[model samples]
Target: MNSAANSRMIEIVHVNRTFQRADGQMVKAVDNVSVVIKEGEFVCLVGPSGCGKTTLLQMVAGLLEPSDGGIAVAGREISGPGRERGMVFQKDSVFPWMRVIDNVEYGLKCRGVPAAQRREIARTYLERVGLGHVEKAWPRELSGGMLKRVAIATVFANGSRVLLLDEPFGALDYVTRHQLQSVLLDLWDEGGAAARRTVLFVTHDVDEALSLADRILVFHSGHLVDDLAVTAERPRSTDSLLLPDMVAIKHKLLAHLGLEKRAKPLAIVQDGAAS
Candidate 1:
């Protein structure tokens, strides 16, 4: 990796998060975790439910403060939510009353972007996400996929250097999820190559993480368990070299949960073989 490639985009050093209950008992949501994501890198966090993946992402997004340690973006500590980091959740967060274009432009509007420039930027991103025609439609009229596209466009229009996605496609159907996966991949590739935006995507689907991430991080019991690099080329297909690696990682995660032997074995065959 070149110096620019090696430079850290997001760094979490000995980060830990704890929540206090009404009775004053402390619950550790995330344990001591250290990770360094490089500029323009696509990294995914995957683990079982309740493993604190979202909590970890929230800490990085500055939505929640950590109990210990620190998180920094581009060498500056993350104090609170800033325009430098954009986030999209599984829920459709777009304002139902606002048109798609207006919602997409809302971030810029808050930042005091002129109306003309904001419209231009929002239009460009909406088109990029294949929602150009729906700009005039309200969130209620758009399909689930279209709503997500609009949300993504909204985030991109903000000119954020980093993206934090927390299972952004989890609610969509299988086909829609796969389709959005490709769309997101294209967007990431375009943004990384052209603008060098770093992304930290959180998903539970093994294939989804394999298809999109340059590296995959496994979290278990509020701790990072593994960090595996995907060495395949860009535009990775289902038959790419990362498939076996993903399968292995999945089994490893199962083992960590003490269910490897009890779990059904994954069908492993040659690439492109019929099930």
Candidate 2:
């Protein structure tokens, strides 16, 4: 919180990533793009599908090597996966063989935390995410939304400085999606204190971005097209979407996603205008 906006926590410098198909054609997944995410800022990467948002997050997590350019964290270049950044994927990464509590503590276990201490910490986070009642349940016993709640809890409990989420709620039902979105915001703020960690969340849904982002970076066809800062107050209400400023922001975000509002047919509208 002491740093200025210019203080960059994550830097993407002229980064490009290309993939080779089995047919020997090279696909440019990420074009030359550069941006900096400040410490404790919550950003949502919004764009159409296949626009390289996830690819970019993967590079940040060191899960994929960039085809060109570079990505750095804390002034050090990221060449491989490290515990400093945590990632949650669209697919649940919860270990099927482990119980909910065990899965939550997996990272701590790997770091050799004493079993009793690790279990207590894991349970604490699980309860925070509203999973305390199911700590003894196995992955197969939980629903899709429950699994995601656990995955998110694990990521936050790991104490990573940066959290990267790749369309994590893309598969959940509408009700569950809204629930988890709220859960994520609460986890990030850590009880109204300064945000505990920097978050770069990816989602194709404009409303999701509006609901959670302190800033939103718009991507189009592998390019960094636009950046927006959402100044709406926290614990934001969905009704705020009707406000003139929020509606304008929504249209702008949709523009980058190749979308527009459709006009109603003359017969369906009152006096040929929207009702």
Query: Which of the numbered candidates is closest to the native, going by highest TM-score?
Result: 2
Alpha-carbon shift of residue 243 in model 2 (angstroms): 2.3
Please give the lDDT score at residue 135 for candidate 2: 96
Model 1: per-residue Cα lDDT over 86-146, one tens digit each: 9998798999999999999999999999999999999999999999988899899999999
User: Residue pairs in steric clash, candidate 2?
Assistant: none
Residue range with the least summed lDDT across 10 consecutive positions in model 2: 266-275
lDDT for each candidate structure: 0.83, 0.85
- TM-score per prediction, in order, is 0.88, 0.91
Clashes of each: 0, 0
